[model samples]
Structure formats: structure tokens, C-alpha cells
Target chain A: MTTRLVEGSAVVAEAMVRAGCRFFAGYPMTPFTEVLEHMAESLPRVDGVCINAESELEAVGMVWGAAAAGARAATGSTGQGLSLMQESIAEAAMAGIGFVVLNMARGQGDYFQATRGGGHGDYRTPVLAPSGPAEVTELVADAFELAERWRNPVVVVGDYYMAHTWVDLDVAAAVPDPPPAPDWALDGSSGGTGSAKLVSPLGTTKQRDGVGYDLAAHYDHCAQRRQAMTEGIAPRAECLHTDDADVVLVAYGTMARYAEAVVTACRTEGLRLGLVRPITLWPYPSEIVAEACAETKVVAVYENNAGQMIDDVNLALLGAAPVVGINGFRTDSSAFGIAPDVTVENLTASVQALFEQYG
Target chain B: MYHRRVEREILFTGIGGQGIQLAARTLAEAAIADGRRAQLFSSYGGMMRGGNSDAFLVVADDAITSPPVVGTAWAAVVMHHEHAAGVWPKLTESSLTLINRSVVAAECRPGTGAVVEIDALDIATGLGAPVAASLVLIGALVGATGVVSADALLDSAARVLPSYRAEAAAVNRRALEAGLATTNLGHPAWSRAEVPS
Candidate 1:
């Protein structure tokens, strides 16, 4: 394994390949386009198939078929494109076919979309929000791992910054070895046989197979699985200076890196600022955020969108401390939704202003 | 003497066709080739040419925290002055700003940082490789700050350029050497990954 200087999208593709994602599909969108390009290039080398589907709908449908055939499949697009795939994603989640969804979002606006999910019912996919390309090397592997292990879809959120940033990463180490094919897959080996297994969203297969079909039981089983997944997956986070912090800030995705940098820089100047960056935005790392802000004066959230993750922060805080939202400092809105604040100067000023009031 | 492990952020500002993108890649790939970690974030307009193009680079021996589009970078390469003003807000006292004197007016230099002026376009035109002016700036970058060796820059240049540019390698090499000749290397913007004492 060697390090290649490449972008975050390429890193995600590399990691997914390393984790044995054998089939991929997606439509072309600005930030998410590179992942599809990389997958198209790399998957063919591994005897895997990657398709640039005509639309997001076709992409998700193709992924669903591949996943049912026991191929570790994935489909991705920006949130706008992903909006079209939510119903299939919901069905796949309910049907219990595992796959990966790369939600390279417009900004942090998709926090609710990824964590809460646009899909209907009580289904939930573990959401992993990596800060940049380096983390993509690890978290993408984590994404496939959770998707397969829980037998449910997984969401890995990326923003424009995460999409464009290039880094040298060898992602093979983080990938889990692909397991042998299970008997449950629809590989056509059972087509001529009398015992044709059906992968169904409803528990109708049991009825056809002489076992009574019980829809309530299936719903209960899925709920229990989601519950188990919530309890089973350990929350991941990065914390700094929280022990002595007077003000604690919560952030995730690319904005969290800036928050982390500003937190460290502020501490040296005697500003008691700390930060909680949730690596798993779905499990939400509520405990870490609350514990870090235990004695803090206020907990502020800096997200690229309009105060979305702040709700999660508030729920994590449980009214123990005041919660505020100072939007991630930004300018120059483009069609691509590039979070173009490159330096921490604007972040520093925003952070300083927060400390003046709360710290 | 490399103790402080801060990411040395470098901003590249220019128009679409000025080779700013290639210049940024050269610096980053060169740093990686030299056994350091680097991240390059590029943002540009839709136009194929004569529109805003910029890149944010973070290089360090330590674990990169992945800075946002850099606010106040440690250095900047200004290939053109049109988009240069926005980058000025992202520089400070310790920063270094390299301006292409052939294209950027003397008054258009950034308000802060020790400025290094190079007639990159004129130099490239002189060498008959006018399109490789950004490579000339890359030469100035390596010369002014020993972030990457001149040799590594050349190797990386060969990789980042379009495959069709294979025949133009020698001309690009001359452009880099010309830019290298105009400055000396000494300023260190990084820490060696050796265990910090």
C-alpha cells in the first residue's frame, strides 16, 4: 500500500474499494462527481462494476440490485441528487439490504438529511462525518463495515471542502477484510431450485416458505436491530481543552477542523474555549458533547448551514447550558456551495466575539 | 530546529489559464515526494479561462488538522492581481507573498508580509515557455522557501501536467531553472517529523 496525493472523493473511493465495495453507481454532480469517476476507474480493475447511471434514481436502483446479489454496493450524490433516492434508500433500509450512501452534501445543510434521514418510517443509517481526506481513509472503511455488519444502509457525509481537498493517503489498512458470500444473497444459484429465497421489504418470504408472514414481527425485528445498532456502535469524537473550558463549541464535517484549530489557538491566548467534533454524527456523540460542556458557560454550534446541527447540540446539552449558533464564517456563495473560508481569521474573529460574551 | 508543527498554508491566486492550478499541485506533490504530508483545496469559476482560480495548501510533518480554505496563510503566490486582493486579508506579518511582476502592478502587492517580486511571465516569455510562468513561480517558491527541492519540483511537474505535454518537458524545465536562478533558498516553513524535543 502506498500513499497517493489525491482528493477526498478519490480517497473515499479508494477506501470503499479497500473495504471490498465491489459495485458502485452514481450520477454526476459537482462535488460528488469525482467519487463516481474514481469508482468507475478503480472498480473495473478489481473485476467490479461501476455505472454512471442516467439519474440518481437509476443509480440507487442499480445499487439495490447489486447489493441483493451479494455485491458490496454503493451509490452517492450531493444532497440535491440524493433527494431523489430517499424512497429506495428507505426501502433498502427496511428490506435490510446493506449498502453505502455517499452524501457529498452542499454544505452542513444535510445534517438532518443524513442523521435524521429523508426516508420514511423508523429506519436509521449510521452517519459518519469525516473532517477531510485523511479521515476519509478511515471513516469510509468504517461506513462499509457498519453497513455490512448491521445489514443496513450507512451514510457518510461530505461537503464541498471535503470533496475538493487533496491528500496522500493509504486507505487499505483501515478496510475490513471482505467476508465470504452468505446464503441469503440472490445470486441466481437458487433460481432453478425449489427453495428460491426472496429478499423482501415485508416479511412475505416467510409466508411463501411455509412460515407465517408477520409484518408486525418484522417491524419489531428491524426496530430492535436499529436499537441494537445505536447501542452497539461506539460514538467517536475529537475533544480539546474541555476540562477547563468556559465555553464549548460543537461542530462537525469540515467546519469542525476550523473549530478545532481555533480552539487550540484560543487556549494558548488564555481563552477558555473547547470543542466537540462528532465523528459519527448519527450516533451523535451526545455523551461527549455534554460531558465536555459540563462546567461550560455556553455551548455554541458553528455549522455551514442555518442552525441545523445546533438542534443536536441542544439535545446533547439538555438545557444544562445555553446553546447558540454562530454560522460558520463564509462568503462567496457559488452554485457548488463551496465553503470558501480558507483561513481561520474569520473563524478567529467569530470565536473571539463568542468568548467576549460567554468565555 | 523544527519544533512548531503548524501547517504552512500557501494560497495561490490567479486567472483560469495562468497555470495557478498546476503551480499549486507542483508545490503539494513536491512536498509529498519529499516525505511530508500535504493537502490541496482548489476553487475556481466555471469559465475555462480568465476567471477566478485559487488553491489552499496545507503542508506539515505533523498530523494535518485540515485547515479550512485558509484565512491568513503563511505564504501566497499571486500570478495575477485580479483575485489577489481577496487573498490579502488572509496574510499576516510572518507571511511571504510572491507576486509576478510582469502581470501584477507594484501597487497591487499585498499589504502585509515580506514581498518577493519575480517577472515570471517575462521570464517565461524569454525562455519561450510563456505558458509555464506558474512553473516559474513554483521555481521562485522552492528558491525562496526550501519547502521542496528544485529536483522534486521538476519530477512532480512531469506528473501533474497533461499527458500530451510530454514533448514540452524540456521547455518547462528551463522555465523552472530560470525562476530558480533569481532567488536563494533558506526560509523554512516546516518542522521535520523527527520526534520533537
Candidate 2:
């Protein structure tokens, strides 16, 4: 594959298009704006439509409309805009209409917002966090497939660092399986056929008319789909020297990249340290984390937020080891923007202190 | 201590409107065009001009494991003195320093890596395109570092220019060639570098 230098946003948009994404609607926000801009530039050439929606709610609503109409559609924004789109995201999940969601978050502060969405339901959004630009290409392609597979909304979580970083990568859509068709999708073909199709969150028209649709039964079906997703889909985690390390650093997204560098540096000095980076934040990769916690003495969770994913890390560990939150809230306090303050030295100190105390 | 670094990192610092972003991107594109793995991460304020602007670049013959917010850089390409003080502490002892002497008047420590001061602004002014000073610095950098070829940089520079800015490609090409002639590093860092399979 011939590598080309491109920013992460371009890589994501290219991957989405390669995955057959035909409709994209999003309101512009910092970091997330680039993805929309890229789609606006690329989609029309492919006979697809890209809309710069006036609001995040409108964007998600447009994506929902497209996805219901059998189009590979997507929308995105940061946490601030995503907060406004939560109701529609929940509706998409409940409505069983699949679409890709990009959360180019301001910082890691939106981990909880992504994993445990503000939308009303017992539904959980399958979230993937790619560490760099190269990984984003594959993950975005997989995200489209995963959303279609479970017939649910899938979120690709990132930060400004991941959105803005450019890398030399061959961004071709590589899906493992042939995606199943959206037979349930609504099109004008069903029009004037005396049997109009219904794509609603409550229940299908066929179910309501034929089986006397039960609301509890529909919710149960949604819950079972989630359960099947948990059992069927394999969680991806990148482990670095976790087999024999005394301390394991738990992180994801860009913060994990920093943790990796620090762990590599410490390993050279004979310090037994490693890192566990969750590629899928929602599935949580509890089994792998539990295994690592069994071997390591201390599990330090490093996040750019104030202990958001630490809850998941704790749940994964299940008291196998002491879990500490190294809240690396790196933000530019001036503009309420992101700051690159998670340095190797600071991470090294956090792990060294834990190693010294626990070892 | 062994840092286990395989990538060469370059940090570019300048004011907002000095074309630091474009220069860094061109360097990355040139590296990719030459079959090297490259990564560029840029940070600047929302200001239209005269704000602190910087870019971090990682060019490697193989996969790069270094994070974008690099703790220490292999080189610093200084285009202006406005934000040079903040970038100096990140340079290691073995880091190369290249400065535009016409615009940057700050004194640079010489104990570290090779320090080469090029009169890029004067050179660009002489070439009749004073705005392409960053390109001049990039040309000199490629000549001194051998990270990419001068011809490849010219090709990539033309490719990166927007459609509206297409009129200035020839002058930018000339500036790059002129900057390349200013440095004397002949051999590339690696000889017989196999084409990545």
C-alpha cells in the first residue's frame, strides 16, 4: 500500500467513504469541524450528500433520517455539541437504526459522556477509541460495520490531539466480513404499495399490527441485542509488557500514547511497568484488564479527565488490585481548550511513585 | 538510559503568519513522497496572525512510536524570535538548530547539535518572494539534514499549495532550490536505504 501523509480528520472521512458512507451531517465545532469539512469536499464527488447542519440536534436527526432510509450515514461533533445530540443518538439506538458517530472531544473529559451516554434508555453505545491517525482508518471502517452488525449506534471517541495529528498512512477500508444488508431500511419503493413501512423507535408497524407489539418485549429485544454484542464481538486491547510488570498503567486514546512512551522509558531502567490501552471503551475489555490486575500490584488509571474511565477500570479489575486515578486533566485554562500537558516525565513520576510504594 | 527512539523529530516555531504550518506539512509530505514514515502535529492559537505557532514532526525509516507531544526534539527550525524562547528548553544536547538570521536576533547556544544560521528572509527578499522565507529555511534544512531531497521538497511544495495560491508555486520552488544550495550536507543519513516493502 502506498502511504500518503494526511491529517487524522481526512483519514477518518476517507475511511467513512470507503465504507460506503453516503450521507454525513454535522454542525461545525473545533477539531470536529475538519471531519465535516473533509466530508463536504469529498462526498459530492462520490454521488453522496454532505450537510453542514445548523445545530448538533439537526445533524444527528439528518443522520438518523439517512440511516433509516438505507444509507451508510454518519454525524459528529465534540462533547459540547454531542451533548445536544444525545436524545437523537438514544433514539437511533432504540430505533435500531445504525449510523456512525464521531466524538472529536475537547479532551478525555467526555469518556463518561461517550460510554455512559446522557440519552434516556438502558441502551449502551459501542465506543472505539483510536490512539493515532493510522489506527483511526481501520477503526472507522470497523465502526461502520459494527454499527450495521448490531443495528445500533457506534461512537468513535477522540480528542484534539487525535483529530489534528497527521501521519503517513494508507487509509483503505478493510472490513473483516461482508456487511449484512439493511433489508429493514425504508425507501420510496414501499410507497403506494398499500403496505407502507414504519421505522420508528417504539415498534415496527408490522409488529404493532400483526403481533400486538409489547413495549416491554421491544425493550427486552434491544437488551438482548446488546447482550449478543457483548458475547459475539471481541474486545480489542493493546498490551505493552503487561505479563511481568509490577505496575500497569490503564489508559486509552491519546493519553495512552503518552503512557506508552513513559512505560518504555521506565522499562529501560529495569522498572517493571506496562500499559493496557483499551481500543473499545464501551465493551471495557474487563477480562484482559482483570488478567493484568491479577499479575500486577498496582493499576494506575491515567486519563485526561477527572476519573471518568476509572469507574470502568475498577469494574474490570473487580478488586483484583488497588486502582488509583492519576487524573491528568490537561486543559488550556484560558480558552477552555485542550492542552498537551501529559508529558513522559509526569507519567514516569506517577508510575514510579506507585511502583515504589507497592512493590 | 536507552530511550528506544527510532524516529527523528523536528520542531518548528514561529509567529502565526510565518507559514510554519505549511513548511512543516511540506516537510512531512516530502518525507512520505521519499518513502519515509512521517507524522506532523501542529498547534497554534485561533488568532489570524502574530500568535504563537508551532509544529512537531516525526520522520522515520520505520514505524514511529514517539508521541506527538515530544519531550525533546532532534532539531528546531526557528523562523521568528517572537516565540523562540519557549521552544529552546525542549532541545537536547544533540539537537540541530537552524535559525533565520534576518528575522531571529536571539542568541543561540552552540554546545548542542550543529547550529546553522541562514539569512532566509534576506534570501527570500532577494528572490522577490519575501513571504516564502519559511520555504527557504525548509530548503536549507533538507540540504543540511538530508532527511529529504531538494527535488522532492519542490514537488511536494507545489502539491500542497491551494488552487488560489497556485500562482506562487514557481517562486516558492526557486526559494526552495536557493535554500538547498546554502547547505553542504551531501550524504543522506542512511545509504542504500531499501524501499519499504
Candidate 3:
């Protein structure tokens, strides 16, 4: 219940402790390094274990091991390190062991492709994107809950901006109880059975069949759980004046804040406009967005990436509104796809042009 | 009923750890304390040390229409040469430019309006803390623009530096006085200079 001027990284750490995260394993990576440092200092105060893993791969594996042993475990890294941890993440996914992975996204490319998409498979991990300090705190709590409820890994994705920015937050109320390991978790002893039963290996025919049947049931249950999560955990999308507007501005994260300002300005000038901010990027609140598009004339998607979220917006709108993308990818040819130097002024002009065209 | 108008937009630019953020925050807090609606936003990049840092502060009696200042600012306090030059184009004819005399060397023109030069480093060192140069500049800003009252400035300082209340309070008070005392800019014809080259 202590209130202090905590940095964004420190806020995330505090949320982790509140969520009953007892085990932390991570490697040092810029921007994200602060999270590890904060955990190293605070976790021990709460009688939790914090391990500085030798490598990113080892860090994820350590969390996997800890979770299997019935402890609330977590790990974090930057883009490159997250890439190295993908193999272990996939294994954890298959095992249905609940754990949390934080990706403080930075420059994207060969050395740091994990920020973009480097998990080595087609699975879309339940990813929560937080723009500022407040969202960071709220999402961390949501991520832990989602992880434990589904018995799978929940990733809280943040960029350099969210990691470094300092914003005021009040988190004395949202802390959860200490996580208890389920009876099914592997804790080295089989309930009163003298003989050890190995449930991991799937090479033998009988073992393979047993594992297949169990995995199939788990996957089916997981599918239904995921659907409920999508409907239940869908982020509250902010729709500003979209009901009777002709042009809708679509944005998320920090960019959405700037777009909100622009929309306010445009409205003052007598231009009819509104904004749709997708708070949850993973669940991709398509239905909510489609409802907005039904009444709007045109939709413009503004993002820091080169059309990463536009595809999803297009799918949601489904030709109900003419969709245009105003992308801001780094044009410097740097490996990191840091949004090319686009300012609010640049975006204002782009929106103005759309307004004139539609008018 | 009389309609109120937005008075001004000001930008404070300097390197990280130079107290630019603090100065901006104080100004906004002071405006709010005086019962005015003020909005502040800052943009800082990878350069924590010796890197380019800038903060925008907008103050008005009414609600702010936009979060960021769009064009020319009414006044600017530049602590570094690069930031001053980078933002030189955004000055209006009546805009006031406060340059740290220790670092910047630029001739003021008619279009760019008045330029106030002060050796903030010297004044801060004399006050026994070189880091207080920002406070000196802020003090000079209050005196020059009359944006906020001197009493408001001191109140803002106390609120921002609450942790260092006992130790640095006296020096900061003196620094503000020094800023108000030294106004060496000769009156120049106010003309809006063409955008900086």
C-alpha cells in the first residue's frame, strides 16, 4: 500500500510482486534492463527468488522449471534475447505451464528480431501492448491473471517509450494473493505412489497415445478458454465522436494519444471525425471496430510500424469503410524499425488531407 | 460576457540532467497553482547524457485545444547551442529568446525580437551550485515575460524540490533573484524573422 514516485519499470516490478510472482529469471538488455534490476532489489524483500540467468534461453527454461515446480515464475528480455528464449517458450506452451514473459521491445531486425516477431512458430501468444506507465501497471496484472487462468504464457509487450517514461500510478489496491501450484504440477512425488510416473516423454506407442489424448483434451479446453478470454478480456476501446462522424482515425499505444489531440483540433475546425484506439492488440477487438466502421465514411490507421496493425483493421472493417494507412517505419535503413521521424505535425497534415478528400 | 484568449506557448530545450524537465514542470505547476489550465509534454531520445532534450509547455486561462504546441512559441529558454539552433525557426517576431551566455553566441535580429543573454554558469557557480543555472534562467524568464508572479515561482520551486527543501532552498531563492537582476538585452525592433536556415 506504499505510494512513491516509481519509474515505469519499478511499477511493473511492483505489479509482479502483487500478482504473487515468486521467481524471476532474466538477462540484461537495455530499456528492459531496469525491470530485472528492480526485481533483483524488490523480489528478495518479499522473500521471492530472483535469478540472473546465464543466457536468454536459459532464463526462459528456468522459469519453465520453476513453474513446473509449482511456483509463480516470470522472465523478461529485449528483442534479441526474447528470440533466443523462443524455443523454451514453445516448450512451456506445449506443457501448459503458466508463466509470464515480458518483452520490452526495441529495434527490430537480425540482432533484435524478437521485437517484431521471432517466436519460431505460428502461434499468436496472448500479447498485451501498454503505452505508458498506467497501462503498464494494469497490463502486468492482467497478464498474470490470463497466464494462470489458461495455464499458458502471457506476454506483456512494451516498447522503449513505455519502458523509460515516468508517469504517476496508484497500485495499492490491485495486488493478488500468492499463487499456489496446482496439484497436477510436477513436484517430484506422485500422490502416495511409490513408483515414479513419467508424463513428458512421447516416444513409446502407449506413452504417445496417452500424451496425445491428454494433449488433445487440453487443446480443446484451451480453445474454449481462449474464446471466453477474448470476449471477457477485450480491452475497452475508446471511440471519440465516431457515431455520426465521416472519417475515423485508428491508432493504438502512444500514437493514439497524439491522434486524440489531432482529432480534437480537427473537430474545432468543423471537420467531423472520431478516433478508435485498440487497447488490446492480440484479441484484436474486431467486432467493436466493425461496429464503428459501419457508421463511418473512411478509416485511417496510424501506427509506428509499416502497416502491422492496418491488416487487422482492414479485416475488421471488411470494406465497410475505405481504409488508409499512415505508416511511420524507420527510413534510415537501421536494423531497428524505429518509426521513421514522424511528428504530430506530420500526422496532423495527413489527417487534414483525408478530411478534405472525404468532404 | 467576455471571451478569454490563450496567452502563449513556451518551449524549454536543453540536455538531459540539465533540469529542463524540472523547469518545465515547475512552470506548469505554477500556472495551475494560479488557477490556470496548463499542459506540458516532453520528448527525450536515446541521448540521456549530452543528448538532445526538449519540453513544451502551454498555458492559458481556458482549456488547451491541443496537447503539443504547433508553430511559433511566445518564448523559449535554450541552455544548449544545438537546441537553440534546432528551435530557432519556431520563434515569432515578439518572441523572447533567453540564451545561456556561457554556451551560445548568436546575434539577435529584428524579426527574432529580443534576446536576453546571461552567464548562467557564472551566476550559478557564485550561488555555490552550478546546477542551479536552470533556476536562474527560469527566474530571468519570470522577470522578462511576466508569465508568472515571482511568488508563484518560489512556490513552484518548493513543490518540485520538496526532498531538498532545507539544503537548496536558500541558494535557489538567490538564483532567482540573480536572474531577475541581470537583464542585458538592449531593446531591438520586434520583427518576425524568416524561418532559420
Candidate 4:
């Protein structure tokens, strides 16, 4: 098999198919729209069902329902659409339904109500942010495993840049063989004992309490599983040139790639600098970051948001290493417009200033 | 092992609806088919139709250090005058600027490189396919740079243009030959190296 160049969304859709995702439901959103289109076009070829829901809320509900019925199910949306799906996602998390959710993230919402904590409350979701096309393919495969092993919802978060960008990928190595869904799955359960009991959320108070207690127990169990999964799959926070480095540059998602370039330039200029790229944004790899900070003088957290990931980086470093944030916000409506040319020269200057101020 | 060096970056500039991205993709694919590492980055801003659309490509044997092509480029294909003027500052001594004679009347740098003016619209219209002008331009770029083999380009056209493969293949071949036969305006020959592949 030869490696073919494929789109990022197409890669995710192909991974879903390989993961035995039999049910997909989502609303169309820019960047993320391609994910839905790909599933619509390719899922049916493999006898999977793709549903374009009326809204993001409905889409999440549909996936929750399908997953509860023991189907390998998935859905996707952008930041705004994801907000609408959070209620359902919270419910799914409570119900122990395993599935994947993709957030082809755009810029953060400008409105106050739609800010960083836009959702109902402070709840942590396991999020994997892919920097490039090759990473997108690999992360999707890993996401499926994480979702299934933990029996919880796994999020594959990509920004507007990542969704639209095209990179040369060895598609043959990326394409995974379709995994066999369990006999409990909807597609695999058809030939089973026709008398299999149906699982429902509604019942008598005693039965409901029993179900609720069982779900709570599962959630308690899930909490442990989530921790183990995060520890096991804690994405390696890439530390480039850190051995003799004085400054540590911390970034995630697409920004990490840019930061690495900046780190290389700084090293050439006789300044010892390194980069820490957090692949798993939710877990944030605090321990790894803390260990790096133990040696470094200062850590600079760079992000597209004003300071979303900065807080986590600060928490990770604690007070061991002084943390500075080099932050920018993309105010453009289009995905391409969002990526303003932050030159290496400018970044190097910023890193130097941070070193003087906090070193 | 065969290696081709593409030091100068090439940026394909055009309007959003002009199929500029497709042309870039085709070229990048052809380069890869010839065993060269290529990166294609297409930028489509807010406007879908009447907005500025551009694609950046870095083709080289070595790993690309910087993805964006900032100052100068080896060549540029401007579908219109506005695009030509917008990217003119990036042209250097080794740059070859190909303009559609029907749309732009820009002057080229003296003794820098040859500028081949072609009425691509007229030729495409004569062929009864105006949209195929992108393929025509791609052919011209191949003829001018000889970065990838003519056969590999045709194969890329067939691979990408799935619906109208036969028509696209024929028109692209003709356009490639037409471009190769065009006068060079006194610059050195820029043709593909003959290899026993």
C-alpha cells in the first residue's frame, strides 16, 4: 500500500471507520464541516450510519443515544457548536458511554458569555490537540483506543489552521484496519439472542436510584480510569535543546510548531533555549512540565488565546520556575486570516526580553 | 538516488475561485511523484469568490526550514494584474514572472529573468474550456522550470482530475508543449534533467 496525500478531516473520518464507528451525528461548522462531509460520503460505503442533526445539541444527544446502545459512535463541532453539546457530553460522561468527539476549534468567542469558561461549569475533558496533518492521523488512532479502554468520551481538538492545512502523509501507514466492534454493538448484536434486554434511562424510583447509583459507581471507577489513561497516554511534552538550555518555551497545538522554530533560532544565536510542546492539552502534563522547570530558569507559555493554556502552565511550573506568557489573539473571521505572520525575529526578541525580566 | 534542488520558493497567486489551490496541489503532487519532498499550504481568507487566494509551496531535497516564502521566489504565476503587482516585491534576480498578457501589462526587471506573456484566457477559450487555464498555466510552469517530468505531471492530472481525466490529460499535454515552445526572452534554459527513471 502506498501513502496517499489526504485531507485532515478525511484522515479523522477514516480513523473513525477503522475504529468501527457505526454511528456519526454532527452539525456543519467551518473546518469541522469537512469531517461531517467525509463521514457522509465514506461511512455508508462501510454500512455505517451518518446523521446530520438539526443542531449541535441534537447531534451530541444522538451520539449519546447510539453509544448507550453499545455502538461505536462519534460526533464533531467547533467551539460554538461544542458549547451547545456540553450538556449532552456531561450526561454522556455520567452514563459511561464510550465514543469520540472532535472539536475543530476556531478562535475563542469574543462575547463575555462565550469566553474560556463558556460551558456550564468547570469540568475537565480529555482533549488531544494535533499540530499537523501527520499528528492528526496518529492522534485519531490513539483517541479511539483511549475512548474504548476508558469507556468515556475522548476529544480530538484541532484548530482552524490544522483543519485546513495540507501536509504530505504516508497514508498507508496511517490507514488502520477496521477494528471489530464488540458483540454488544448494534451492528454486531442483530444475530444475538433476540431476547436481549433493553437498557433505558427511565424507570421507577427504586430502579432509577439503582441505575443512578450504578452510574455514579461507574463514574467513580471512570475517575480512576481517566487518571490512569491520562498517565499512560500523557502526550510527551516535546523538549527541544533543553539539556543546556536556560529558557523553556511552552506551547500546544499549532503554536508548538512555531515555537520550536523560534527555539532553534535562539539556540543558533548562542542562547540556550528549549521547547515544551504539550500534545495532551487537558491533562496538561503538569509533572513533565514541573520536572523541566526544575532545571530551567524561566518558562514562557505561548498561545493563540489571550491566556487559556497559560494558567495550566503556571500551575505546572508552580513557583519553581518563573513563568511568562507570550500571548496573541486572532480576530480574523477566516481560518487563514487568523494565522498572522509571527516572525522568528519577533519571537526571538520576545524570548530575550522574557529572559531579562524573569531569568 | 536522484535529488533535485528547489531552493527558490514559488507562490501561486490568484482569486479565490480561480483554481489556484488545485494548480499548486497538482505541482506539489507531481514533485512528490518524482521522489521530491514538497509542502503545499493554501490560504483562503474570508471571501470565497472575490477575495485574494494564494498558495505557498516549498519543494526541495532537504527538510524545509521555513514554511512561508517571504522575500523572493524562483517563479510566480499571476492569473491577474492585481496579483502580479501584489507579489512583485517578492521577485528577485532569479525570479521568472509569468503573466497573462490579456490581463496584466507589468514590466519585468531588466536581465533578471525572462517573462513569457501568454493570453491563457484566449487559448483556454479556443479550446472550449476556460476553467482549464489553470492546467495550462501548470503546463507552462513545468516547461519553464522543468522541476518535474512532463509524464509525471500528466499522471498527476489523471490522478487528481478524476471526473474529466481524459479531457484534462489531453489539454494539459497540449498546453505543456505550447508553453515549452514559447520564446524564452533571452534567459538560460530551464529544463528537467534527463534521468533513466
Best by lDDT: 2
Give me the runs in candidate 3 sitting further than 4 Å from their true place. Answer: A1-6, A107-117, A120-122, A170-179, A186-236, A329-341, B1-10, B16-49, B55-75, B88-97, B107-116, B142-197
Q: Give the TM-score of candidate 1.
A: 0.92
Q: A275-314 in candidate 1: lDDT tens per residue?
A: 8889999898999998999999988898887788898888
What's candidate 2's i-RMS value?
2.1
- Candidate 3 local lDDT, A1-359, one digit each (tens): 43233456787888789878999999998667889999999888878999888988888888988887878889988877887888777656556677888887752222123223455433345666665566676678788887887766778766555554443343476445686777756788875555443323121112344444455555555556546655666555778878878888887766676688777767777788888887666667788789887877789998766566787788898888899988745632222233434455677798889878876
Docking quality of model 1: it rates as medium
Off by over 4 Å in 4: A107-123, A173-235, A265-269, A329-337, A343-359, B1-8, B46-48, B62-74, B81-96, B105-118, B162-169, B183-197
Per-residue lDDT for A4-97 in model 2, tens only? 7788788888878887888999999888998999999988878889999989989999999999988899999988899999999998888889
| Tens digit of per-residue lDDT, candidate 4, span A1-359 | 55465666777777678767878999998778988999998888877899999999889888977876667788988877887877766555544456888877764222121222244322345677776665676787777777776666778777666665555566553334456654444443444445433333221112344444354545455566556765676555666887767889887766776777788667666788888877776666788788776788888887766766777788787788778778774543355325444445557788988778765
Error of 2 at A91 (Å): 1.3
Worst 10 residues of 1 chain A by lDDT: A170-179
CA shift of A240, model 2, Å = 1.8
Off by over 4 Å in 1: A1-3, A170-177, A191-193, A204-214, A328-333, B1-3, B186-197
The sequence of per-residue lDDT tens digits that candidate 1 reaches over residues B82-190 is 8888888878988998889999977797777788899999999998888899889879887888777677777887777667878777888788888888888656654
Interface RMSD, all models, one decimal each?
A: 2.5, 2.1, 6.0, 4.7
